[model samples]
Target: MSGQRSDTECRGTHEWVSAAPFRSHLADLVGTTGLPWRAVALYADVPTRCVRSLLFGRRGRVVRRIPARVAERLLRVRAAQLNGLTARSGDAWAAHDLASRLAGRGQSAAEIALLARATRDEAALWLVGPPGWVSARSVLLLQAACHAAGMDWAGPADPWEPSPAEAAA
Candidate 1:
Protein backbone atom coordinates (compact mmCIF):
# COMPACT_ATOMS: atom_id res chain seq x y z
CA MET A 1 0.00 0.00 0.00
CA SER A 2 3.05 2.24 -0.04
CA GLY A 3 3.97 3.59 -3.45
CA GLN A 4 3.77 6.73 -5.56
CA ARG A 5 0.23 6.75 -6.88
CA SER A 6 -2.14 9.28 -8.35
CA ASP A 7 -5.16 10.41 -6.37
CA THR A 8 -7.27 8.71 -9.02
CA GLU A 9 -5.53 5.38 -8.62
CA CYS A 10 -7.66 2.55 -7.28
CA ARG A 11 -7.12 1.71 -3.63
CA GLY A 12 -6.66 -2.02 -4.09
CA THR A 13 -4.68 -3.53 -6.92
CA HIS A 14 -5.90 -7.13 -6.76
CA GLU A 15 -8.70 -7.76 -9.27
CA TRP A 16 -11.11 -9.78 -7.20
CA VAL A 17 -13.80 -8.71 -9.64
CA SER A 18 -13.79 -7.37 -13.15
CA ALA A 19 -14.93 -3.80 -13.69
CA ALA A 20 -16.58 -4.24 -17.09
CA PRO A 21 -18.98 -6.92 -15.93
CA PHE A 22 -19.84 -5.04 -12.77
CA ARG A 23 -20.45 -1.77 -14.60
CA SER A 24 -22.66 -3.43 -17.20
CA HIS A 25 -24.59 -5.15 -14.44
CA LEU A 26 -25.00 -1.84 -12.64
CA ALA A 27 -26.24 -0.13 -15.83
CA ASP A 28 -28.96 -2.70 -16.22
CA LEU A 29 -29.90 -2.24 -12.59
CA VAL A 30 -30.15 1.54 -12.96
CA GLY A 31 -32.34 1.15 -16.03
CA THR A 32 -34.70 -1.30 -14.35
CA THR A 33 -35.04 0.56 -11.04
CA GLY A 34 -35.41 3.95 -12.75
CA LEU A 35 -32.59 5.04 -10.46
CA PRO A 36 -31.12 8.21 -11.84
CA TRP A 37 -27.61 7.78 -13.15
CA ARG A 38 -26.44 10.36 -10.66
CA ALA A 39 -28.08 8.52 -7.76
CA VAL A 40 -26.70 5.11 -8.68
CA ALA A 41 -23.30 6.58 -9.35
CA LEU A 42 -23.54 8.41 -6.07
CA TYR A 43 -24.51 5.34 -4.07
CA ALA A 44 -21.81 3.27 -5.68
CA ASP A 45 -19.15 5.88 -4.88
CA VAL A 46 -17.76 5.83 -8.39
CA PRO A 47 -15.56 8.77 -9.24
CA THR A 48 -16.69 11.26 -11.88
CA ARG A 49 -13.78 10.37 -14.10
CA CYS A 50 -14.45 6.67 -13.63
CA VAL A 51 -18.17 7.07 -14.21
CA ARG A 52 -17.55 9.04 -17.37
CA SER A 53 -15.20 6.36 -18.51
CA LEU A 54 -17.79 3.69 -17.78
CA LEU A 55 -20.77 5.45 -19.36
CA PHE A 56 -18.87 7.10 -22.15
CA GLY A 57 -15.59 6.15 -23.81
CA ARG A 58 -13.19 8.20 -21.79
CA ARG A 59 -10.21 6.36 -20.34
CA GLY A 60 -9.48 6.44 -16.61
CA ARG A 61 -8.25 4.30 -13.73
CA VAL A 62 -10.65 1.68 -12.46
CA VAL A 63 -12.10 2.71 -9.10
CA ARG A 64 -13.78 -0.29 -7.49
CA ARG A 65 -14.41 0.15 -3.77
CA ILE A 66 -18.07 -0.88 -3.91
CA PRO A 67 -19.51 -1.52 -0.46
CA ALA A 68 -20.56 -5.10 0.13
CA ARG A 69 -23.98 -3.73 1.04
CA VAL A 70 -24.36 -1.62 -2.07
CA ALA A 71 -23.16 -4.50 -4.19
CA GLU A 72 -25.72 -6.75 -2.55
CA ARG A 73 -28.46 -4.16 -3.10
CA LEU A 74 -27.52 -3.84 -6.73
CA LEU A 75 -27.60 -7.63 -7.07
CA ARG A 76 -31.00 -7.86 -5.42
CA VAL A 77 -32.32 -5.00 -7.51
CA ARG A 78 -31.05 -6.61 -10.65
CA ALA A 79 -32.58 -9.93 -9.69
CA ALA A 80 -35.92 -8.34 -8.86
CA GLN A 81 -35.93 -6.48 -12.14
CA LEU A 82 -35.19 -9.67 -14.02
CA ASN A 83 -37.94 -11.51 -12.12
CA GLY A 84 -40.41 -8.62 -12.38
CA LEU A 85 -40.72 -8.27 -8.63
CA THR A 86 -42.49 -5.25 -7.09
CA ALA A 87 -42.47 -3.23 -10.34
CA ARG A 88 -39.60 -0.95 -9.39
CA SER A 89 -39.28 1.04 -6.18
CA GLY A 90 -35.81 1.95 -4.99
CA ASP A 91 -36.86 2.19 -1.36
CA ALA A 92 -38.37 -1.27 -1.13
CA TRP A 93 -35.04 -2.50 0.17
CA ALA A 94 -33.35 -0.94 3.17
CA ALA A 95 -29.82 -2.06 2.31
CA HIS A 96 -29.62 -5.21 4.40
CA ASP A 97 -28.09 -7.10 1.55
CA LEU A 98 -24.83 -5.38 2.25
CA ALA A 99 -25.09 -6.26 5.90
CA SER A 100 -25.84 -9.85 5.13
CA ARG A 101 -22.97 -10.11 2.72
CA LEU A 102 -20.62 -8.51 5.21
CA ALA A 103 -21.69 -11.02 7.80
CA GLY A 104 -21.08 -13.81 5.34
CA ARG A 105 -17.63 -12.34 4.82
CA GLY A 106 -17.04 -12.55 8.60
CA GLN A 107 -18.53 -9.23 9.71
CA SER A 108 -21.09 -8.96 12.48
CA ALA A 109 -24.58 -7.46 12.35
CA ALA A 110 -23.60 -4.69 14.77
CA GLU A 111 -20.67 -3.78 12.58
CA ILE A 112 -22.80 -3.82 9.45
CA ALA A 113 -25.42 -1.60 11.02
CA LEU A 114 -22.81 0.87 12.16
CA LEU A 115 -21.20 0.97 8.74
CA ALA A 116 -24.55 1.34 7.01
CA ARG A 117 -25.60 4.18 9.25
CA ALA A 118 -22.37 6.03 8.78
CA THR A 119 -22.52 5.46 5.04
CA ARG A 120 -26.10 6.72 4.81
CA ASP A 121 -25.21 9.79 6.80
CA GLU A 122 -22.14 10.48 4.70
CA ALA A 123 -24.09 9.99 1.52
CA ALA A 124 -26.71 12.43 2.76
CA LEU A 125 -23.99 14.93 3.57
CA TRP A 126 -22.71 14.70 0.00
CA LEU A 127 -26.21 15.64 -1.30
CA VAL A 128 -26.51 12.09 -2.73
CA GLY A 129 -26.33 13.51 -6.27
CA PRO A 130 -22.99 15.22 -6.42
CA PRO A 131 -20.14 14.13 -8.67
CA GLY A 132 -18.06 12.87 -5.73
CA TRP A 133 -21.01 11.14 -4.09
CA VAL A 134 -19.98 7.60 -5.01
CA SER A 135 -16.35 8.03 -4.11
CA ALA A 136 -17.23 9.59 -0.77
CA ARG A 137 -19.73 6.88 0.09
CA SER A 138 -17.30 4.16 -0.92
CA VAL A 139 -14.57 5.60 1.24
CA LEU A 140 -16.87 5.97 4.23
CA LEU A 141 -18.39 2.51 3.89
CA LEU A 142 -15.02 0.82 3.49
CA GLN A 143 -13.51 2.69 6.40
CA ALA A 144 -16.46 2.09 8.67
CA ALA A 145 -16.91 -1.52 7.65
CA CYS A 146 -13.25 -2.25 8.03
CA HIS A 147 -13.25 -0.64 11.44
CA ALA A 148 -16.39 -2.39 12.61
CA ALA A 149 -15.14 -5.75 11.37
CA GLY A 150 -11.87 -5.26 13.28
CA MET A 151 -9.92 -5.59 10.06
CA ASP A 152 -8.33 -2.19 10.62
CA TRP A 153 -6.41 -3.41 13.67
CA ALA A 154 -5.95 -7.05 12.71
CA GLY A 155 -2.65 -8.44 11.52
CA PRO A 156 -2.08 -8.69 7.76
CA ALA A 157 -2.20 -12.46 7.75
CA ASP A 158 -5.27 -12.47 9.91
CA PRO A 159 -7.09 -10.49 7.29
CA TRP A 160 -5.58 -11.93 4.11
CA GLU A 161 -4.28 -15.32 5.15
CA PRO A 162 -4.89 -17.98 2.56
CA SER A 163 -7.43 -20.64 3.33
CA PRO A 164 -6.09 -24.14 3.97
CA ALA A 165 -7.01 -25.27 0.47
CA GLU A 166 -5.41 -22.26 -1.09
CA ALA A 167 -2.28 -22.82 0.96
CA ALA A 168 -2.24 -26.37 -0.25
CA ALA A 169 -2.61 -25.13 -3.82
Candidate 2:
Protein backbone atom coordinates (compact mmCIF):
# COMPACT_ATOMS: atom_id res chain seq x y z
CA MET A 1 0.00 0.00 0.00
CA SER A 2 1.13 3.54 -0.66
CA GLY A 3 2.17 5.66 2.31
CA GLN A 4 -0.69 7.99 1.53
CA ARG A 5 -3.98 7.28 3.27
CA SER A 6 -7.48 8.50 2.47
CA ASP A 7 -8.78 11.43 4.49
CA THR A 8 -11.70 9.27 5.56
CA GLU A 9 -9.31 6.80 7.10
CA CYS A 10 -7.39 9.51 8.98
CA ARG A 11 -10.10 12.03 9.69
CA GLY A 12 -9.17 12.73 13.30
CA THR A 13 -5.51 12.05 13.00
CA HIS A 14 -2.83 14.73 13.22
CA GLU A 15 0.24 14.22 11.09
CA TRP A 16 3.14 16.61 11.09
CA VAL A 17 3.50 18.54 7.87
CA SER A 18 6.37 17.13 5.86
CA ALA A 19 9.63 19.03 6.16
CA ALA A 20 10.33 18.72 2.45
CA PRO A 21 7.40 20.90 1.45
CA PHE A 22 8.06 23.39 4.21
CA ARG A 23 11.69 23.53 3.15
CA SER A 24 10.77 24.21 -0.43
CA HIS A 25 8.31 26.92 0.52
CA LEU A 26 10.87 28.46 2.84
CA ALA A 27 13.51 28.50 0.14
CA ASP A 28 11.17 30.19 -2.28
CA LEU A 29 10.10 32.85 0.17
CA VAL A 30 13.56 33.52 1.51
CA GLY A 31 14.97 33.70 -1.96
CA THR A 32 12.61 36.54 -2.75
CA THR A 33 13.93 38.54 0.21
CA GLY A 34 17.53 38.71 -1.10
CA LEU A 35 18.78 37.97 2.38
CA PRO A 36 21.59 35.46 2.87
CA TRP A 37 20.87 32.32 4.85
CA ARG A 38 23.21 33.38 7.64
CA ALA A 39 21.57 36.77 7.85
CA VAL A 40 18.15 35.17 7.98
CA ALA A 41 19.28 32.78 10.65
CA LEU A 42 20.77 35.59 12.70
CA TYR A 43 17.74 37.80 12.38
CA ALA A 44 15.33 35.00 13.15
CA ASP A 45 17.50 33.49 15.91
CA VAL A 46 17.31 30.14 14.12
CA PRO A 47 20.36 27.94 13.88
CA THR A 48 22.22 27.95 10.57
CA ARG A 49 22.39 24.16 10.63
CA CYS A 50 18.62 24.02 10.68
CA VAL A 51 18.47 26.16 7.57
CA ARG A 52 21.09 24.10 5.80
CA SER A 53 19.32 20.89 6.70
CA LEU A 54 16.03 22.27 5.43
CA LEU A 55 17.56 23.66 2.28
CA PHE A 56 19.87 20.79 1.45
CA GLY A 57 18.35 17.87 3.41
CA ARG A 58 21.39 15.60 3.73
CA ARG A 59 21.93 14.74 0.05
CA GLY A 60 23.41 11.32 0.73
CA ARG A 61 23.32 11.25 4.51
CA VAL A 62 20.56 10.71 7.02
CA VAL A 63 17.99 13.48 6.74
CA ARG A 64 17.47 15.66 9.73
CA ARG A 65 13.99 16.60 10.84
CA ILE A 66 13.50 20.34 10.75
CA PRO A 67 12.39 21.39 14.18
CA ALA A 68 8.84 22.73 14.24
CA ARG A 69 9.82 25.87 16.12
CA VAL A 70 12.44 26.65 13.49
CA ALA A 71 9.87 26.21 10.73
CA GLU A 72 7.42 28.43 12.59
CA ARG A 73 10.10 31.07 13.11
CA LEU A 74 10.95 30.95 9.44
CA LEU A 75 7.29 31.47 8.65
CA ARG A 76 7.31 34.51 10.88
CA VAL A 77 10.46 35.77 9.20
CA ARG A 78 8.77 35.43 5.84
CA ALA A 79 5.71 37.23 7.09
CA ALA A 80 7.84 40.02 8.47
CA GLN A 81 9.62 40.44 5.18
CA LEU A 82 6.38 40.37 3.20
CA ASN A 83 4.81 42.89 5.57
CA GLY A 84 7.91 45.13 5.57
CA LEU A 85 8.43 44.74 9.27
CA THR A 86 11.83 44.87 10.96
CA ALA A 87 13.39 41.89 12.70
CA ARG A 88 13.27 41.94 16.49
CA SER A 89 15.49 40.72 19.32
CA GLY A 90 14.28 37.41 20.70
CA ASP A 91 11.66 34.69 20.19
CA ALA A 92 9.40 35.47 23.13
CA TRP A 93 6.81 36.84 20.74
CA ALA A 94 6.71 33.51 18.99
CA ALA A 95 5.85 31.64 22.19
CA HIS A 96 3.24 34.23 23.02
CA ASP A 97 1.78 33.93 19.54
CA LEU A 98 1.57 30.19 19.78
CA ALA A 99 -0.10 30.42 23.17
CA SER A 100 -2.58 32.94 21.87
CA ARG A 101 -3.41 30.77 18.88
CA LEU A 102 -3.90 27.75 21.10
CA ALA A 103 -6.20 29.72 23.40
CA GLY A 104 -8.18 31.11 20.47
CA ARG A 105 -8.76 27.56 19.36
CA GLY A 106 -10.24 26.79 22.80
CA GLN A 107 -7.39 24.47 23.56
CA SER A 108 -6.42 24.05 27.19
CA ALA A 109 -2.95 23.67 28.65
CA ALA A 110 -3.52 19.97 29.06
CA GLU A 111 -4.53 19.71 25.44
CA ILE A 112 -1.48 21.69 24.37
CA ALA A 113 0.66 19.50 26.54
CA LEU A 114 -0.76 16.44 24.85
CA LEU A 115 -0.09 17.91 21.45
CA ALA A 116 3.40 19.05 22.40
CA ARG A 117 4.33 15.82 24.18
CA ALA A 118 4.93 17.84 27.32
CA THR A 119 3.57 17.87 30.84
CA ARG A 120 0.72 20.22 31.76
CA ASP A 121 3.03 22.26 33.96
CA GLU A 122 5.54 22.59 31.17
CA ALA A 123 2.95 23.69 28.69
CA ALA A 124 1.60 26.21 31.17
CA LEU A 125 5.11 27.44 31.81
CA TRP A 126 5.77 28.05 28.13
CA LEU A 127 2.52 30.00 27.87
CA VAL A 128 2.79 31.99 31.08
CA GLY A 129 6.43 32.76 31.57
CA PRO A 130 8.87 35.08 29.79
CA PRO A 131 9.29 32.51 27.00
CA GLY A 132 12.45 31.25 28.60
CA TRP A 133 14.11 28.04 27.52
CA VAL A 134 11.49 25.84 25.93
CA SER A 135 12.88 22.67 24.42
CA ALA A 136 13.02 22.49 20.61
CA ARG A 137 11.28 19.13 20.73
CA SER A 138 8.25 20.66 22.43
CA VAL A 139 8.16 23.40 19.80
CA LEU A 140 7.96 20.78 17.07
CA LEU A 141 4.91 19.28 18.71
CA LEU A 142 3.22 22.65 19.29
CA GLN A 143 3.90 23.70 15.71
CA ALA A 144 2.19 20.51 14.53
CA ALA A 145 -0.85 21.44 16.56
CA CYS A 146 -0.84 24.93 15.05
CA HIS A 147 -0.70 23.45 11.56
CA ALA A 148 -3.53 21.00 12.24
CA ALA A 149 -5.70 23.82 13.54
CA GLY A 150 -5.06 25.98 10.48
CA MET A 151 -3.55 28.67 12.67
CA ASP A 152 -1.02 31.18 11.36
CA TRP A 153 2.30 30.66 13.04
CA ALA A 154 3.42 34.06 11.84
CA GLY A 155 2.54 36.56 14.56
CA PRO A 156 2.48 40.33 14.86
CA ALA A 157 5.72 42.31 14.68
CA ASP A 158 5.89 43.10 18.35
CA PRO A 159 9.28 43.55 19.95
CA TRP A 160 10.12 40.39 21.82
CA GLU A 161 12.64 41.97 24.15
CA PRO A 162 11.65 44.24 26.99
CA SER A 163 12.02 47.93 26.26
CA PRO A 164 14.88 49.72 27.94
CA ALA A 165 12.39 51.46 30.20
CA GLU A 166 10.69 48.19 31.05
CA ALA A 167 14.06 46.57 31.59
CA ALA A 168 15.12 49.28 34.00
CA ALA A 169 11.85 49.03 35.88
Candidate 3:
Protein backbone atom coordinates (compact mmCIF):
# COMPACT_ATOMS: atom_id res chain seq x y z
CA MET A 1 0.00 0.00 0.00
CA SER A 2 1.70 3.14 -1.18
CA GLY A 3 -0.92 5.25 0.53
CA GLN A 4 -2.63 5.60 -2.84
CA ARG A 5 -6.19 4.37 -3.13
CA SER A 6 -6.37 1.19 -5.14
CA ASP A 7 -8.40 1.20 -8.33
CA THR A 8 -10.46 -1.79 -7.19
CA GLU A 9 -11.49 -0.03 -3.98
CA CYS A 10 -15.10 0.96 -4.42
CA ARG A 11 -16.51 3.58 -2.08
CA GLY A 12 -20.21 3.15 -2.81
CA THR A 13 -21.92 0.19 -4.38
CA HIS A 14 -24.96 2.15 -5.48
CA GLU A 15 -24.72 5.85 -6.08
CA TRP A 16 -25.11 8.39 -8.85
CA VAL A 17 -22.32 10.82 -9.72
CA SER A 18 -21.64 13.58 -12.19
CA ALA A 19 -20.86 12.31 -15.64
CA ALA A 20 -18.81 15.34 -16.59
CA PRO A 21 -15.54 14.08 -15.04
CA PHE A 22 -16.01 10.58 -16.40
CA ARG A 23 -16.89 11.87 -19.84
CA SER A 24 -13.91 14.16 -19.82
CA HIS A 25 -11.59 11.35 -18.74
CA LEU A 26 -12.93 9.05 -21.43
CA ALA A 27 -12.54 11.75 -24.01
CA ASP A 28 -8.95 12.21 -22.94
CA LEU A 29 -8.32 8.48 -23.22
CA VAL A 30 -9.78 8.40 -26.72
CA GLY A 31 -7.73 11.37 -27.82
CA THR A 32 -4.53 9.98 -26.36
CA THR A 33 -4.97 6.33 -27.37
CA GLY A 34 -6.71 6.89 -30.70
CA LEU A 35 -9.08 4.03 -30.01
CA PRO A 36 -12.79 3.68 -30.69
CA TRP A 37 -15.27 4.14 -27.85
CA ARG A 38 -15.93 0.41 -27.65
CA ALA A 39 -12.29 -0.50 -27.08
CA VAL A 40 -11.75 2.29 -24.60
CA ALA A 41 -14.84 1.32 -22.64
CA LEU A 42 -13.77 -2.33 -22.58
CA TYR A 43 -10.39 -1.33 -21.17
CA ALA A 44 -12.09 0.34 -18.24
CA ASP A 45 -14.95 -2.18 -17.86
CA VAL A 46 -17.59 0.46 -18.59
CA PRO A 47 -20.68 -0.07 -20.72
CA THR A 48 -19.66 0.92 -24.21
CA ARG A 49 -23.15 2.03 -25.14
CA CYS A 50 -23.42 4.33 -22.15
CA VAL A 51 -19.97 5.77 -22.77
CA ARG A 52 -20.89 6.44 -26.36
CA SER A 53 -24.11 8.10 -25.36
CA LEU A 54 -22.32 10.11 -22.71
CA LEU A 55 -19.70 11.32 -25.12
CA PHE A 56 -21.84 11.81 -28.23
CA GLY A 57 -25.18 12.58 -26.58
CA ARG A 58 -28.21 10.34 -26.91
CA ARG A 59 -31.29 11.61 -28.78
CA GLY A 60 -30.20 15.19 -28.30
CA ARG A 61 -30.24 14.57 -24.58
CA VAL A 62 -27.29 15.33 -22.35
CA VAL A 63 -26.20 12.79 -19.81
CA ARG A 64 -25.92 14.58 -16.50
CA ARG A 65 -24.85 11.66 -14.32
CA ILE A 66 -23.85 8.03 -14.44
CA PRO A 67 -23.65 5.07 -12.10
CA ALA A 68 -20.98 5.37 -9.43
CA ARG A 69 -19.31 2.20 -10.63
CA VAL A 70 -19.17 3.52 -14.16
CA ALA A 71 -17.70 6.78 -13.01
CA GLU A 72 -15.17 5.04 -10.77
CA ARG A 73 -14.01 2.65 -13.46
CA LEU A 74 -13.85 5.39 -16.05
CA LEU A 75 -11.93 7.66 -13.75
CA ARG A 76 -9.45 4.87 -13.00
CA VAL A 77 -8.56 4.48 -16.63
CA ARG A 78 -5.17 5.81 -17.76
CA ALA A 79 -4.30 6.77 -21.29
CA ALA A 80 -1.50 4.18 -21.53
CA GLN A 81 -3.76 1.52 -20.05
CA LEU A 82 -6.20 2.06 -22.91
CA ASN A 83 -3.75 0.29 -25.20
CA GLY A 84 -5.63 -3.01 -24.50
CA LEU A 85 -6.05 -5.83 -21.99
CA THR A 86 -3.45 -8.55 -21.62
CA ALA A 87 -3.16 -11.91 -19.95
CA ARG A 88 -0.83 -12.00 -17.01
CA SER A 89 1.16 -14.94 -18.35
CA GLY A 90 -0.03 -17.30 -21.03
CA ASP A 91 -0.27 -17.62 -24.80
CA ALA A 92 1.51 -14.39 -25.49
CA TRP A 93 1.58 -14.09 -29.31
CA ALA A 94 -0.66 -16.95 -30.37
CA ALA A 95 -4.03 -15.37 -29.67
CA HIS A 96 -2.79 -12.04 -30.88
CA ASP A 97 -2.18 -13.44 -34.37
CA LEU A 98 -5.34 -15.54 -34.41
CA ALA A 99 -7.52 -12.58 -33.45
CA SER A 100 -5.91 -10.50 -36.14
CA ARG A 101 -6.75 -13.16 -38.71
CA LEU A 102 -10.35 -13.33 -37.59
CA ALA A 103 -10.57 -9.54 -37.64
CA GLY A 104 -9.00 -9.43 -41.09
CA ARG A 105 -11.65 -11.80 -42.37
CA GLY A 106 -14.35 -9.32 -41.40
CA GLN A 107 -15.54 -11.06 -38.26
CA SER A 108 -17.25 -8.56 -36.03
CA ALA A 109 -16.41 -8.56 -32.32
CA ALA A 110 -19.90 -9.83 -31.52
CA GLU A 111 -19.58 -12.64 -34.05
CA ILE A 112 -16.28 -13.70 -32.58
CA ALA A 113 -17.70 -13.77 -29.07
CA LEU A 114 -20.75 -15.73 -30.22
CA LEU A 115 -18.74 -18.30 -32.13
CA ALA A 116 -16.26 -18.74 -29.31
CA ARG A 117 -18.96 -18.97 -26.65
CA ALA A 118 -17.16 -16.10 -24.94
CA THR A 119 -18.15 -12.74 -23.60
CA ARG A 120 -18.16 -9.52 -25.59
CA ASP A 121 -15.47 -8.12 -23.31
CA GLU A 122 -13.09 -10.89 -24.28
CA ALA A 123 -13.63 -10.32 -27.95
CA ALA A 124 -13.12 -6.61 -27.61
CA LEU A 125 -10.03 -6.99 -25.47
CA TRP A 126 -8.18 -9.51 -27.60
CA LEU A 127 -9.44 -8.54 -31.05
CA VAL A 128 -8.34 -4.95 -30.71
CA GLY A 129 -5.23 -4.09 -32.71
CA PRO A 130 -1.59 -4.72 -31.74
CA PRO A 131 -2.54 -6.74 -28.70
CA GLY A 132 0.07 -8.61 -26.71
CA TRP A 133 0.07 -10.94 -23.67
CA VAL A 134 -3.24 -12.64 -24.46
CA SER A 135 -5.03 -15.20 -22.33
CA ALA A 136 -4.19 -18.85 -22.98
CA ARG A 137 -7.90 -19.33 -23.46
CA SER A 138 -7.84 -16.61 -26.07
CA VAL A 139 -6.02 -19.03 -28.38
CA LEU A 140 -8.75 -21.59 -27.84
CA LEU A 141 -11.59 -19.12 -28.27
CA LEU A 142 -10.18 -17.66 -31.45
CA GLN A 143 -9.47 -21.13 -32.75
CA ALA A 144 -12.94 -22.33 -31.89
CA ALA A 145 -14.35 -19.28 -33.58
CA CYS A 146 -12.29 -19.95 -36.69
CA HIS A 147 -13.23 -23.60 -36.81
CA ALA A 148 -16.89 -22.78 -36.31
CA ALA A 149 -16.74 -20.14 -39.01
CA GLY A 150 -14.76 -22.50 -41.26
CA MET A 151 -12.00 -19.96 -41.70
CA ASP A 152 -9.40 -22.54 -42.87
CA TRP A 153 -7.22 -21.40 -40.01
CA ALA A 154 -4.14 -22.94 -38.38
CA GLY A 155 -2.93 -22.56 -34.82
CA PRO A 156 0.58 -21.73 -33.74
CA ALA A 157 3.09 -24.32 -34.98
CA ASP A 158 4.84 -25.12 -31.70
CA PRO A 159 2.28 -27.73 -30.73
CA TRP A 160 -0.68 -26.94 -28.50
CA GLU A 161 -0.17 -25.59 -24.99
CA PRO A 162 -3.40 -26.53 -23.34
CA SER A 163 -4.78 -24.08 -20.82
CA PRO A 164 -5.69 -25.48 -17.43
CA ALA A 165 -8.78 -23.32 -17.26
CA GLU A 166 -11.98 -23.76 -19.22
CA ALA A 167 -12.25 -21.83 -22.44
CA ALA A 168 -14.29 -18.64 -22.28
CA ALA A 169 -11.80 -16.14 -23.67
Q: Which candidate wins on lDDT?
A: 3
Candidate 3 per-residue lDDT, tens place, 78-159, comes to 8655443333344646565667678788977777666544577766776664354455434555654554445554422110
Better of 2 and 3 by TM-score: 3
Candidate 3 matches the true fold with a TM-score of: 0.48
The stretch of ten residues in a row with the least summed lDDT in candidate 3 is: 154-163
Clashing pairs in 2: none
lDDT, residue 147, candidate 1? 35
When summed lDDT is taken over every stretch of 10 residues in candidate 1, the lowest stretch is 152-161
Name the better of 2 and 3 by lDDT: 3
Error of 1 at 68 (Å): 11
To one decimal, what is the Cα RMSD in angstroms of model 1 from the true structure?
Answer: 13.6
Expressed as tens digits, the lDDT of each residue in 1-169 for candidate 1 is: 1222233443443224434665777778567655444445444433323334455543454544433323343444343533242233332122333344465577554554445444444334333233222333333344335433443222112112234876698
lDDT of 1: 0.41
Count the clashes in each prediction: 3, 0, 0
* CA lDDT of each prediction against the hidden true structure: 0.41, 0.56, 0.59
Mark the regions of model 1 whose C-alpha exceeds 4 Å error after superposition. Answer: 1-8, 11-16, 59-169
> What is the alpha-carbon lDDT of model 3 when measured against the actual structure?
0.59
Ordered from best to worst TM-score, the candidate numbers read 3, 2, 1
Candidates sorted by lDDT, descending order?
A: 3, 2, 1
